[model samples]
Target: MSHSLQHEPAQGVTPTLRLRPDTGKPNVRLRKQSDGAYRRHPDEIKEDCLSQPSEQIKLDISVADYRVVSKRDSEDTVQRMRESMKDIPRSKRAAEVKCEIIQIIVMPQLVDMRYLQTATDDVIERAVEAHFVYSSIYLIPGLSLAASMCAAFHRDWSWNARGVYYRHYYSPHWITGDHTLWIPTIDHDMFDHPQERPRRERAQRLLRHALDNKRWTKSEYAWEADAWSDVFGQIRDDPALAADKRECYMNMAEVYPVSATLTGKSEMAKRIPDASIGLATFHPQHYQNAIASYELDSERLQALTLHRKTSLISDPRLGESDLVYPFLVYEAKGWSGDPRDARLQACAAGATYLDMLDALARHPGPSGKVEGAYQFAGSRSAQVFALTSFGSHWHIMVGYRRPRLKREHAGHPGMSKTVYLYQRVWSGLISDERKAWELLSLIDQIHEWGVTTFRDYVIRHLRSWHKFGRMVWKGDAERMRAVLGKDAATSGQFIIFSLPSWADGFGTDFKAELRQKSGRLMLKRLIDEQAGEPSITCVQGSCRARGYKCFSPEDFVRHCSSVHDNHSGESGRSVVKEVFDQAASDMKETLQELRANCYEIGPEADTSCAEQAWTMVHDNTCIESPTRYN
Candidate 1:
C-alpha cells in the first residue's frame, strides 16, 4: 500500500490516505421519509452515483494456484487486511497481540469463496453487482476464526445498503457481519442475469462438495489403520517391498509428522481433532488415466515427492494404499522448512485437483455422475458434495487450441490456465507451543476446507481459463469489453465474460519481471502497452469482436460497425475457434505466499494495519443487449 501511496515526483508529495469517494461522512446525507422511514438524501445518492469506485474486486488466485510468490506478500496481504478495517470498529478497540500475531485478519478477497457460497448461498446468493462484504479473522489457533468472519460480513452489510436495492429490503437475520456476506456479493446485472450463475456455480459447488465427506481423523479413520499398518509392516519386513518409496512413506507416517493428521502429532502428546492424514497413491487407477491422457506421459513421474526433513533430498512415493484419503506432505525436517517449497508442494497438490475436475468433467466418476467421482474407493453411489485428494503434481494442462486442433478428452480442451500463490506458512519455523497447536489445527482446516476451496477456484478458473472470465453479474460483460477490448469474449446470454485471450497469455504476469531485467516497467512505452493488450491468439472465425485483423482502435471500430455492432447482444456472443498458444505463459497472481516469514515492521508494525490497496474498480454499466460499437 505504501508503494501505491508513494506518488511520482511530478505529483509532488506522497498522497494522504483518502476515503473512498463514494463513501465518507461528506458523501452521506440522511433524510426523513414520508412514511416515517429514513433514507439517503438525494445529494448523497448523487455523490455515490458520481463517485462510487468499483463495488467489486476480482481476486486472481490463479497465481497461488500455479506458481510461487514472494513470501513477503503474505505479511503484506495480512497487513493490508488490517488497514482496510482500521476504522471498521466504530466503537470498539481490537484485542492486542503479545510476542507474535495470533490475531491475524484475512482479506475479503483472499477468504475462500467456497465458505462464502456455502454459508451465504442460501441466504444471500451469487449475482452481478449484488454487492458483498466478507472478512475473516484467523486464530493462530483457528477454532474461533469461522465465527469471526461470519460476524464481520454481517457487520459491514449496511455499508452498501442505501441507493441499492438492499436498502429497503429487510436484512435476513442469518445474513450478517457475523457470517460470510449473505447478500449477493456480485454486481446488479450478475444478480439479474438469468443463467450464468447456475452454470458457473454448478462446477464450483461440485468442487466445493467433493471433499465434504473425505476428511478423516484417528477415531473416524481408525478402521483404515490396520490396512496402513499392513502396508507399512510389509514394506518393513519384506526386503523387496522395502524400496525407497516404502521407506519414505513409513518414515513419514510413523517417524516423521508427514501424515501428521493421521498419525497424531509427535510434538504434542495428544492431537486434538485426532485427524488422520492420507497420502496420494502413485499407481492409483486415476493416475494411470491421467498419464494415458498425456501427450507424453513419463512412467517415472507417477510418484509424488516431498522434501525429506531427515535429509536434504526429496522423497518420492504414492501414499500408503487406501488410508483415510486426504493429502499429506512430510518433511523429516519439519513442515514447510522451505516455505516456498511447501507452497509449491501445496500448489502441486492443487494443480492435481484441477486435473481431477477436468477428468470428472470429461468422464464419469464412481457414482457415474459427471459432476464428481464417488467419494470412497469402492462406493457405487456417488455423493454430490465431496472431493478426494491425493498428492501428485501433474503436467496435464487443459487449455485452448484452435478449433481444428481441439480434441475431446475427459474435459474441455479450449480452456487455458494460469496459477498464482494464495495462503502459505513456513510451518517448520513454528517454535512456540501455541503456534504448534495452532499449526495442527490449521492443517486440518486446510485438508477439509482449504484444498476444496482451491479446487472450487480451479473449477472457476478452469472456466475463466477456457475464456469464461470471472462471473459477470448483470451487465459487467460490456464493462469487460471496455477494459479487455478485443481480448475478451462472453458466454451465451452474456451471462459470463471471459478473457479468452488470457488462455493465449494476456494475463498480468507478476513473475514475468523476474526474467524481465529492470522489472516490467522497464519496457519501452509502446512495447509495454502492446504487451499489456491482448495478443491475436484466438481464431476469430466466429466472434468478430475478437478483431483478428484489426490493429488500431479505428480498425476495431470499423470492423465492429460493419460486422458486430448490430449483432452484438447474446446472439453476437460467439464461440470463437480456440487456438492454443503454447508460448503464451500468462500467470500473474499477486496474493501473498507465506506468513510466518513476514517479520518486518512498517505497514505491518501495528496489529490493525490499515490499507485498502488491493482493489480494482471496473464495469459500471448494467449491460443489456450487446453494447453497440461507437
Candidate 2:
C-alpha cells in the first residue's frame, strides 16, 4: 500500500496529466477544443465545448436555454430557422411532430359572364330532357285540382303557373293526356323569399290547429255560421251598393271559377238548363272584386280562387253530369244472398260481366243493329264501368263471377259439383286470346279428367309434384322428415298406415294387375258407399264412425283412383310402372299445370276459393283418421 505505481510520461507529451487511481483502468477526461484545456467530466467538457466556437461554428442549445438567451438573438435565430425550414419538403416530416404555420393571402378575382351562360345553358338542357310525359286527354282536371289543393293547404300561395291555367282552358284534355305539360306552381324565388315568412308561419299555425282538432267542424271557424249568414244577407239585400265589399269577402273565402267545354257538338250540353248553374258557375266579377278589395297579393288571391273553384265544381253535390260530364248509371237487385253463389249461377248459365261489358261497348242502343246491354251483377252495389271514347255506356256489370263452395265428396263441406261449374266458367272467361291460354289448357285437362273440384286438383297435383321436385333436386331425406314432423305437429295428428306382411302371389307383373284391380274395386266401392243414405250432421257415435258419412272410405279410395288415372294417362300396363316410378314427377307437372290454369283464370276467383278452403280447414279443428289395416 505504501509503494506507488508510477508510469513515466512519453517524451513528446505534456507532463501535467494526472495519474488515475487504478493504473489498470483507462483514464477518461473532458476537454475543450477552443483553448486546449482538460476537465474532469464529459458534462464540464461539453459546457466548455459549447462556449468555445470558430467563426463558422453555431451552438445547438435546448429550447429552455435558447429562450434565456437575449430576445433579439432568439428572434433572429427563430426567423432564420423558419426560413431554412421553408425549403424542406413537407411530406418528409412526421405529422404529429411537424410545426404548424398558418398563412393568409389576399388576391383579386374576376368572373366571366360567358362561363355562367354556358353552365346555365347546360342546366336548362338537362331540365328540358328530364321533363316527364303524361296523357293530356286523361287527367287534366284532377291534376289541376291536386296542384291547387296542395298550394291552398300549404299556404305558400302563388299562381305563377297561370299561363298553364289559360292553356288548360284551350285544351282541357291536353293536360289530361300529358300531366307533364303543367309546371309546379311553387318556384325557387317564391319559396326562398323573405316575404313568404309570414305566410309560412300562418300556415304552420293552421296546420297545428287542424292536427289538434282532429276533425273539420263549423265551430273551428273564427266566425260563427250565423255571423257568416248575416254578412251574406247584407250582400244579397244591397247587391250593387256593397258589390266591392261582397267580392272582397268572397275572395277571402277562397272561391274560384270553373268552366266545362262542349266537346264534339254534344246535345247533352244544350240540354243542361241554365238554372242548373248552382255551384258549377264561376262568377268572374266575384273573383275580380275579391282580388282587388281584399288587399291580398296577386299570388295569394289567385291560388285561393283556383283552389275554391276546383273544389266547388268537383263536389258530387253539384250533380254528376254538371261536374263530371260523362255519366254511366247502374242498378243492382235480385241476387242470391251469397255473392259467390250468384257468380257461379251466372257462369254456368254462360253469361258473365266481362261478356256483357264487351257486348255493350260494341253496341250502345236497343236497336237490332246494336249489341244489347252487357250487364252482369258485380259484388254488392259497387258497379265498375269502362268509359267509351265519348262518355257513353260501353259495358255494364252487376257482379264478379266466382267459384261456388266446395262439397263434402271432394273433402269439403260445400257442393263440389257446383264448385267445379264455377271453375269451368272461370276457365272459359280466362281463356280469352288476350291472356291465360296455358292455364286454360290445364283447366281443360282437369275438367276432361273429371276432377271433382279445382282445389282438389291443385292440392293433389302439388303433393305429387312436390315429391318429384324434391327427388330431382336430390334433397335430403332428413329435411323432408323435419318438414313432415312440423306438419304433423301443426296438424296435431300422425299419419299411420300398416303395410301387408306378405306380397300377393301374382308374378313380377303383379303391380300392374293390382293397380288396375284396385282402381276397379275403388269405383265399385264408391258406388256401394253411395248406396247408403248419408247424414249431414253427427250424433254421439257420429256418422263417420258408423260408416254413413257424406264421404266414405270407398269414396276417398275412388277419388285416389281417379287422380291416379289422370296422372297415369291411358297407356295401360306400362303406365302402372311408370306411375309408380315417377308419381312425384307426374304430380309436379300436374301441380304446375294447375297453378298455370289457376293463374290464367285470374287471381280474384282462385284467391277467394283458396281463402275459403283454408278458412274451412282452420275452422274444422277435429282431426281423426282410421288406420289402414291389410
Candidate 3:
C-alpha cells in the first residue's frame, strides 16, 4: 500500500522520492545504483535520476502516479532530459531547449554572456520580489520580459517568424540565419468582383481555345466581355493585376504534389485558423507576356482551414479542410507605452475569426459570416490564445480545446488543465540581439511542446507540485520528479516568484499594496472592477482594505471619491492615481486581470518596479508618489 515512510537521509541529504511507474508507493526514497537504475532505499535521498529510456517516440507522461519532485530537481532533471534529446529529430524528440532563471542582467557593455553563472536561490527570490511587479505591466515591455522564458520554450511563434521571410532581413547573429521556419502556406487574390480574377483567367484561356475551334457562342462571348470589363477597370490587357505570384500560383492539380507540413512546432503542423493563412500571390502583368517574371506580392489572403465559419476570402473554387489548429499568430506594431490593449483587441478579432471557421467542423451549412472576414468579440472562448504575437512581443495566452476527450490528464478526468502557462509577455525580446537570440535558441530547443503536450506538462508535472506539500524549490529530490519521462517538463521558472515576500494564497502582494496603500487608488479601483474580492486584510491596514473590498469595483473610481478634498487624503494617493490613469488608459486589455490575487498564482506585489528591469526604460509619466522611490 502507498504510505509515507519514516524520515531518512543518505549522507546528510534529506531528499524526497517518488516511484517512476507500475509501482505502489505514493512517496519513497529512491537512489540510483552504480549501474544507472533506481532502487528504493529507506535512508537515502536520490542524487541522480534514471537515465532516459531507449524507445524514442517522444515518450508520453502518465498523469496519474506522477509525483512532483522539488523545483531544483525538477529543473535539473528536465534540463538533462532535454540535453539527451539533442540528437533526436524534434518531431519525435522530447524537448528542444534548456532555460534557467537568473538575476536580470544589466544591458551590454563589453559583454560575454556564454559564461554567466546561475544566481543563488536567495538572490533569485529577492530579485523576483524586488523587480517582477504587476504595476510594471503598465510599462508594456516590462510585462513582456516577465513572459519571455515561457514563450522561448514554446512552438507557436513559428507562424509570425515565417512572415519575416516575406520581408528582406539579414541578421548574422541568428543560428539559422536564412532558414527560420517553413510551412505550406497559401495567399488569395482580391478584386472588385470576388471571383473576378479566377473567372477572367479561366475565360481568357477558354476563349483562346474555343474561338480557335469555332465553338464559341455570341451570347457567351458577351458574358466573357463583361467579365473582362470587371477584370480591367481602365486598361484593356492588364493581366498583371489578376496573375498569380510565385509560391501562390498553384496549378490546382499540382498543389498536393508540392505541399508538405514541416515537422514539430512548425505552424504548418498545428494549422490553426489565424496562423495557417493562405495567400494569393501575383506577378505584375504591365504588358501581357507569356513568360512569368519578377517576385511575388500577395494581394488577398485566405484561411487555410475554416475556424468557426467559412472565410469570405476563402476561394470558393478550392477546398480548405486540411488546416485545423492555429499554432502561431503575429501582429506587428511600433513601440509605445500603451500597446497591450490594442494588441489584445487584435487577438480578440483574430480569435473571433477563428471561431467562425471552426464552426465549419460541426456545422458546415451556410452561415451569416463569410470566408474571409469574421466578427470580433462578444463570443464564448474569445481570449483563448495559443501562440499570438503583438508587434515585436510574443504571448501565449490562448487555451486549447480538445475536440474530444481521447487522452487522460494527470489527476483530473480528461485533459484536466485548460490553462497551460502562468506567464504571458515575450515582446521584450528585442533591442538586444543576444537576448532575442537566446529566446530563439530556447524556442528551437523545445519546439515540439505543442498544444496537447503543453497541456499535459502543465497538469502532469507543473500543477502536480501543488498536490504535494512542497511550495518552493527547497532542493528536495523526490518532490521534483514526476511520471513525466522528459519529452518536456514544466519550465520551473515560476520558482522565481515562490518566495514568501510575494503573496501566495487568495492574492498577490501587488493587490494588497494597491488596495491597502494610499497611492494608485484610481488604478486600484479600475482593476477592482474586473478582479476585486472579499479579501480580509492580513496586515495592519486590514480594516480599511476590507471596507474598500465591500464596495463594488466601480464605486472607488477616483482617489478623491472617498474624500471630498485632496487635503483630506494622504499626499501621494490622489496625485499618483491621476498620473497613472492618464498613462495606463492606452492599454486596458493587458491590465484586465493584472492583479492575480490567488494563492495558486502567488502575489502581484512581489513583482519588482520598472527601474529594476533592463528592457523597459522608465518614462516617469505614470508615477506621482514620492514613496514610489522608497
Candidate 4:
C-alpha cells in the first residue's frame, strides 16, 4: 500500500524530492489524486531540500598603468642637487665630534644614577659615593702623573727603555702624545731599615746594575726613546690630566729639594731682588756657607756645567716646580729592566694621570669666564688594572673622572654626555669579566626593570639565559610560570604532553557500572516515550502463546509456585502478564478520571493524566518477575 502527502511550497513548504523506488529508475513522480487533491508519492517525498544559488554576485578587476623615466637623466639631476648643497665644514665637524665626546662622557652618569636606583637597590648610590672618594684619592692623581711621566719619559728614555715601558704600561699614550708628571717619595727610613728588604731598593739596585753592565745598547735606547716620547706627548695633551700636578707632587718627597746660596755683602746688597729677599730669611745660614765655597766648586765644575747648560739646585721649592715636568721621564727610566718595579711605576703613573684628568675635566672654566667659543673640556678618565696572581685575576678601578658641569646643565639635555665615565678591564680578568657579562644579561632579560632601560650589553646575555631555562626545565609548568609567566608559556610554539601516573584505582569497577546504568536508563526513557506499548512480536510470542493457561489456579498449584509468584512457566510468565494487565486497567481508570476532571474543571484545564499513568507504571515495574520454583 502507498500513501500520498500534500505538497505545498507556499504553506507547508515542499520537502526535498527523492527518486521513486516503484518506478525502478532515478525519477520523481506525483502520486494519483486522493480526496480530490494531487499529492506527492511516499517514495518521491524528500528528506532534504535542494539548495538554490544566491542572487548576489561578486566581480573582480585587474588594472595596469605605466610611467617612463631615463635612469641617466635622474642620476644627472640628483648629482647636480648634491653638488649644490655644501658639505659640513671641518670646524663644525670637529665641534660635533667634541660635543659627541662630551655627551658620551657625561650623559651616562647622570641618567644612570636614576636608572640604577630604579633597577637595583641602594648599592648604586653607595658605588657612586665610593667612586667619588676613589677619584679624589687615586684616579685623578694617578692618571695625571702617568700621562705626564709617559710624555716626559718617552722623550727622555732610550729606545730600549721606551719599548719596555710601553709593554709594561699598555699605554694608549702611543695614540695621544700627552705626557703626565708624577713624583713618588722614597722613604729614607724605609730603605735604611735592616729588618725587611724594600722593593724600591731592590728595583733600584737591579736597574743601577743593569745600567752599569751596559745591558741596553744606544740603538735600543734610541728606538725606545722615540716611541716613549710619542706616547708621553699624547698623555700630556690629554685634556683629562690638566689639573693633577699638585696632588702628584704632594705625595712624593724626592720630587722636591732643599738648597742653599750665598753672596758677598756688597754684591748681595745690590742683588737683593724682591724675590731673593723673600727667600733669604728661609736660607740665611745655608746661603752664607754656599757663598764661601762657590769660587772653588764653580771653577771645578764650569766645563761640565757649560756643556750641559743646566742648573741643579737642591731647593725643595725649585725641585717641586721643576720636577713636575720630568716625573714621567724618570719613571720610564725606572721601568726598563724590572717587571715588579715596572708594574708599580705604571700603576702609580696611571693613578696620577687619571687624577689630573679628573681635576681638569671637572674644572669650571677659569673662574667667571664665559664665551661662546668651544673649548676642549677635560673629561673623567678611569683606569682598570688587572693583575694575575696564582692563576687568578684581580681587578681594581684605579682612576675616576670628576663631575664638572654647569648647574643648569647638570639636569640638562647634555649632562649625561659630560658626566658619564667608566673604565672596563677588557681582558686578563676572567671571573670579573664573567660577572660583568652576567649582570648585563640580567638587565637585558627584564628589558624594563621597574623603569630602567636595559643596555645592549645586557640584551646579548639575557637571550641565552632564557634558552637555558627552557632547555633545563623542559615541561615543568610551575617552574616556567615562576620564571616567565602564564602568557610566555602559552606564547611558545611547542606543546608539552604529560599524563598522570596509573597508580590510582577506583573503589568500584566504574567502567562496567556506568555502561550498565546508562543502558538501563536509556531503555526506561524509550519505553516511557512509547506509553508502555510492547512491540507486536513480543505481544504475540510471549503473551498470547501462554494465554490463560499460565493464569489458571490449577497451573499454579501444579507447579508448587512460591507465595511471590503465580503459576506461569518455570520463569513465572503468568506474573509478568498479570502485571501488564493491571497496568493497562490502571491506565484506563486514569483516563476516565482525567476525562471526568476535565468536564468538571472545564476543557481548558490540563489534567496531565497520561503522564501520571506512565509514572505509576514505571515506578511499579520490576526488572524480573518472581520464578515459580523460588
lDDT of 1 by residue, 1-630 (tens): 345766465565775787656653565445322110112222222222222124211122222321233245456778987786687664453543224433334333322233433443233122201222122211011111122342343222211110001121222321222222111122334333556444344323322322231222122233223223311222223211112212212111122111011122112111111112332223334444432212111221111110010010111222112221222322111111221222223333333322333332322212222334323332221011111111110011111111110110112111122221112121121222232233233333443442344224323322221221111221242233323333333211111112111112223462232223211111222132222222222223456433244333344434555754444443333221111121112211111211122222122333222111101113222122132222
RMSD values, in order shown: 29.8, 40.4, 31.5, 50.9
RMSD of 2: 40.4
Better of 3 and 4 by TM-score: 3
- Candidate-wise lDDT, in order: 0.24, 0.24, 0.26, 0.26
| Candidate 3 per-residue C-alpha lDDT over 237-342 given as tens digits, one digit per residue, 9 for 90 to 100 | 3232221111111111101000111122211111112222211233355225542222121111122111112222222122221121223333322222113333
Cα lDDT tens digits, model 2, 1-630, are 597699877989987857657777556754332111011222332232222123220123323443344355657778997787776677754552456543221111222222333344344222221211011111111112222232222111111111010011222222222111211122335444677564444434433433232222223132212212321223223222111110000011111121111111211101111011001112335666522222112222221111211111111121111211111111111111122222222222222222222222221221224334323331111111110100000111112212221111122111111111111111111112211222222222322222122212222322322233222212122111122222322333221111111112224463344334333322332333222111122212223323322233344333334533323234533533343334334333443543444432222445454333323322322211111111
Q: Locate the minimum summed-lDDT window of 10 residues in model 3.
A: 249-258
Give the local distance difference test score of model 3: 0.26
Cα deviation in Å at residue 135, candidate 4? 23
- How does model 1 fare in lDDT? 0.24
- Point out the worst 10-residue segment of candidate 1 by lDDT: 303-312
lDDT of 4 by residue, 315-419 (tens): 112212211111121122211222223233434444333333232223122212441221122121222221111011112222232333231123221112122
Q: How many backbone clashes does candidate 3 have?
A: 65
The local lDDT score (0 to 100) that residue 230 gets in candidate 1 is 19
Off by over 4 Å in 4: 1-223, 229-250, 253-336, 363-630
Reference-based TM-score of each model? 0.19, 0.13, 0.20, 0.15
